[model samples]
Target chain A: MDLANTSLRQLASALHERRISSRELAQAYLGRIERLDGELGAFITVDPEKTLAQADAADARIARGQAGPLTGIPIAHKDIFCTQGWLTTCGSRMLSNFVSPYDAHVIEKFAGAGALILGKTNMDEFAMGSSNETSHFGPVKNPWNLAKVPGGSSGGSAAAVAARLAPAATATDTGGSIRQPAALCGVSGIKPTYGLVSRYGMIAYASSLDQGGVIAPSAEDLGLVLNAMVGFDARDSTSIDRPAEDYTATLGKPLKGLRIGLPREYFSGGVSSDVAQAIDAALEVYDRLGAERVEVSLPHSALSVPVYYVLAPAEASSNLSRYDGVRYGHRAAQYADLNDMYERSRAEGFGPEVKRRILTGTYVLSRGYYDAYYLQAQRVRRLIVNDFREAFEQCDVIMGPSSPTVAFGFGEKTGDPVQMYLSDIFTISVNLAGLPGLSIPAGFGAAGLPVGLQLIGNYFSEGRLLQAAHGYQQATDWHRQVPDMARA
Target chain B: MALTDTDLKRLARLARLRLEESEITGLQGQFAGILGLIDQLQAVDTRGIEPLSHALDLGLRLREDLVTETDQRARFQSVAPQVEEGLYLVPKVIE
Candidate 1:
């Protein structure tokens, strides 16, 4: 079997049986990275020395018969998570030289699990843009079609997994960053309910909407990694205190009697016909599995994009205030005054999209405009959440297309920021409602690019969500298709 | 609502972003487009709806007031753009 093609679970078993050494596995993935990463641009940082050192440590643990299921498995992380002693540039020049002094909670958790840090993948600067084009590191191309964008801000993670550069990679979703990219790149990704995963040291995007998740080739793979990734940390005040669960436990359960809601707003205009057909075909698979499909209405779902733009930026402008010239970020060499230094430094540090969001944020929160824009958006957010609440009452989980369309060519939507923002319309509401949402590869659409079927469950319903996704995945081979880059 | 040049300047200052003269026209257009898209919020009558601050309504988690971290200022300051004697340096405020 191809080492890169193996699943995280299969790799774990192989490592446990001494069929492969961790160092050898790391070297194999490193070789693949060195060969394909130049064209793909998936990773921002890949340290062979650090990766081998971690693998050697895992080998020692395995030698002592103390190996966990994830021991010796290599996983990439989105650059948004702070990794100690590694360049954690969240795809922005502001942090281009900033090596993290500590590990993010997600990074620390993976380390404790004995999983080797393969590398850090590129992302939209500060998780700001839907397409990876906004990255200071340069755009991460789609693995399936190099001319098209790999959906972002988790584009690098999604592309890496799609191309089999890594078995799995850590991602964060605030306004569909994880799910939309996964859809475009044809991978499985899950954004747990807010507070389910500790956000400590994961750079804030939209505070309330941001949640760390995983992108891999299959739901079973996502479940296996999420099992080790979720927990409460006192360090993060928003971390939820919940009993640990084996997310893979319900994977084998049948989908009989499962009620999946089809939101009317999702199928309306904006979704391409090809994507709609793929989603419809996916629902048919569920129907064949004895699952009941119920039509539900989320009338206010159409407003999620508007509400997200307001609230996410409002929080981002505040959260990003810490990146001043005085602190650990970019600073101008010449400045006449303190305020000029702050202004010029930020002006030079942030990208166009980031700067736009910050200005929009500042404008919305400014004295006279606060009530009209920020407060109004917040109230509408409640209405969107209410729509989901009412919809869930009619069904067990909500189903829809992850993205309105498949991956578009580079620079297609970048010209129009509103157009770029609308690409996330389908997945944004899940973040707004703080629900567990998953995107699984259902089938191909335009140009044979993958289409993702989204599964949204009520708060803390990750087990049910994963079970339903796994059920669908087992019945279809869409999740099994790999880009030629990996096969080559 | 259309944003005037004065309004854009005020927003730039509030955001602490220094916009080059060349960036103004483009930014104004982009900001207008975004604001126009966000104007959709105005169509919804949210008079009785309460603004949601969080997705989950969980109460603030309280913890004992204690120093749980070691002093890593030296390590932290190592990455600062300008640091002197373990202090982060900025442009002088006093003459």
Candidate 2:
């Protein structure tokens, strides 16, 4: 069997059935990563020795009859998540040499579940830029088309999964880091209800808007991964406190009676004709399954891009203040005084994109400008949230295109930050409203690139969202379409 | 609403970044174009609506006002460029 392309659930069963040893599986993936990742640029770092050690321990645990659901499954994580003893560069020069003292809560949970640590993947500097072009490490090229972008922030994690460098990976989405890239790469990924996954020790980009998520081959795999990664942690004040439920329990459940919302604004303008056709076709599949489709209007949809830019950057400005050459990162060699050292070190460490956001954030938050810009943006944010609330009253699920268009070539919009930010317009409002959202492969665009269909759910409805996405995956083969370049 | 080199320099300083003159000019052009597009948000009437921050409306749930600190000082300082006597070191400010 081609183990590299299999889902996490299937791999877990194979491990339990003695079809393959965890160490052997780890070696197979690590070897594949070594051979393929340089061309793909999916990983920022891969520690084979450390990876094999964890795999060995997992194999021993199974031998001792103590294996859990995720035990021995290999997964890479976005570099933003701090891992103790491993270099955690959030795709920026600022924390280039910084080694995390403690593991992020997600990383800690995965270790407890006996997951093999494959490596850390690349991303945009501090999870900014929608196309992965702003990364100080260099743009992560799409495996589908090397000249094209792989999508941003969480682009490395999405690319890694798409290229089969890792079976599953932990990714964080501030705006659309998880969902947009998943769509661009033709993979299954979900950004759970805000606070579903604890953010303790994860490098903060936008404090109020960031959430750790998963990217994998199928919605079933995403379900299994999300179930394992979520729960309340005392360390993260924002962590949700609901009792844990099996996220994959309804994977094969029928979609009958499910109310899918089709927002009119999403279908009109912006979205490519090919993407709209695919989404419309998806709605037909839901109809054939005895589900009902309702027309819903999120009148404030267009305002999401602006509201998010103001609020996310405002939080990011405050959060990123910790990186001032005092605690960690590159310090200036020549400094006459302490003040010069702090200023010069920061000026050198952070890249241009990070600087832009910090500047934009600081300006909006400055005394005279706060009420006019930051406060007003916050007010608009609530109106957008209310729009979602009224729509959810009519539909259990919201369906739309993940991005207005498919992956554009690298440098397509790097010069224009607004055009770059518009790439995430469809996915940002979920963070604003604190709702759960998922992205699954819908079909191919006119450019022969993958197109993603997004499923937005009411808050804490991750299970229902996965069930709908899984049902769609079962009937169609979109998720099964691998880029010829990345396949075996 | 066009951003100038002066605006770029001020914003860059507020962000603690030092850009070459060339980069500032490039950024100034890009920022001007972006600002022109984002100003459309001002047309909406959001006068009375409350601004939403967190997804869930729930307020902070305090966890027993207890102090918690880890002894990962050695691990934390391992990445610091300069350190001495259990504290980060920098050039003398009052020497």
Candidate 3:
């Protein structure tokens, strides 16, 4: 069997059964990366030597009869995360050649869980753009169609898993980064409630909206990775303290009597016809399993896009200030004075989309504008949050499309920043409300692109969300289709 | 459709971005368009509703103000394009 096509569960079983050495699995994945990553642009950094060493260690542990669910599993992380020995550029030239001396709490937890470090995937610089095109490195191509675009920010991570370069990869979402790409690339992913996963070492991007989560073959695998990653980390003041529980415990739970809330607003906007049909199909799967659909309303849901643009960039402007030429990023080789040097360095380091966010962020946060723009957006943000709280009172979970449409062509919306930002419209409000959200394959669109259905849950309701997704997956086969895994 | 030189420079300084006149014009147009869209939220009536930064009804964690020492100044500086002593060095700013 091709190890690269294998799921995390199968790989773990192979290691446990001695059918494949953990080192062999690592070597196979490294070989796949070597073969496919060049055209796909799925990775920014791949340390094969270290990965093999990690694999050897895992094999030794297995030999000693001590291995957990994820032990020896090879995975990658979005470039946004800080990896101690590797360069964590977050797909920007500003931090180019910047090596993180310490690991983010997520990375530390993965290492502790005995997961092998495959490499770091590419993303929109600073997680600003919805398409992977914004990365300084270049756009990541959709594995499904190399000519088209992969979804952004976490686009590289989703594409990597879709391309079978890695069985799973870690990703971050600040306004739909994880869910959007997972939708476009036909994979399963979850964005845990804000603060559910530690953000201590990930580079800040719109700090309040940013959340780290996992993308994998199935929700069951996502549960395994999340169990290792989520927990309180003192270094991150936003980290929440909660008792650990197995996320996969209810994968087999019956779906009878489950209340799935369908928000009218999520289905009313610019969603494509194919995407609507897909959402309807996904609903039917739940219905077949004895789940009932309940109508719900989030009056402020349509305002999410407007509110996110203001608040996200406002925080982005503040968080990105540290990258000034003076602190740690690139600086000009020659300058007449300090001001010129700073200006030139920033101009040279940041890309167009990133530069736009910094300016918008600055505008909203400016002295007189703060209250009118930033604070007002914050207040409207509460109405959106409260809307979700009210919806959950009527149903067990809220469902919608992860994005308004499927992946657009590469360079399609790059010229228009407003159009580009709207890609996250369906996904951002969850971050605003700090609610947990999940994206699973609904079905394929007319162009044969993947469409995602989102499930939003109440605070700390990740277990219920996963249970619902798991139940849906049990009733559907779309989640199991392999992507060109046997092509080569 | 594009930002004037004056607005560009002001926006740059506001962001603390320190951009050149050339960079400002390109950035300004993009910001205007983006901001124009975000302006739609202004239509929503949310008077008296508190601004929210998180969904949970939680308060900040207060920790005892104390130094927790774990130094690897050398390690922390590994990503710096240039560094000197225990601090990061930059283009000379003190006139």
Best by lDDT: 1
Best by TM-score: 1
| Angstrom error at residue A462, model 2 | 0.3
Model 1 achieves a DockQ score of 0.89
Per-residue lDDT tens digits for candidate 2, residues A1-488, read: 58546878788988988789898989999988888887788888899999999999999998898999899999999999999889899998888888887899999999999998999999999999788887778888897888889998889999988888888899988888999999999898999988889999888988888999999989999988887899889789888788999998888999999999989989888988888888888889888988998999999898889888788878988888777787788888787676667667877888878877787787778777687778888888888889999999999999999998888988788777888899998999888888888999988887788899999999889999999999999999989878876666
RMSDs, each prediction? 0.9, 1.4, 1.7
Q: Estimate each model's TM-score.
A: 0.99, 0.97, 0.97
- The regions of model 3 sitting more than 4 angstroms off are B1-3, B18-25, B64-66
Error of 3 at B24 (Å): 4.8
Question: Which portions of model 2 miss their true places by more than 4 Å?
Answer: none
Give model 3's DockQ, 2 decimals. Answer: 0.67
Candidate 3 global TM-score: 0.97
Show pairs that collide, candidate 3.
Answer: none
DockQ of model 2, rounded to 2 decimals: 0.67
> Which lDDT tens digits does candidate 3 get at residues A1-488?
57535667888898899999988888888888898888999999999889999999999988998888889999899998898888889999998878888899999998888899899999999998898999999999888778777898899999998888888999999899999999888888999989889899999988787899999878888898889889999888788998998898888889899999998888775898999999998898899999999999998877888888888888888888777677577887777776777777887888877877788788788888888889899899888888988998999999989988887898899888888888888898899999899999888996788889999888888888999998888888677765674245
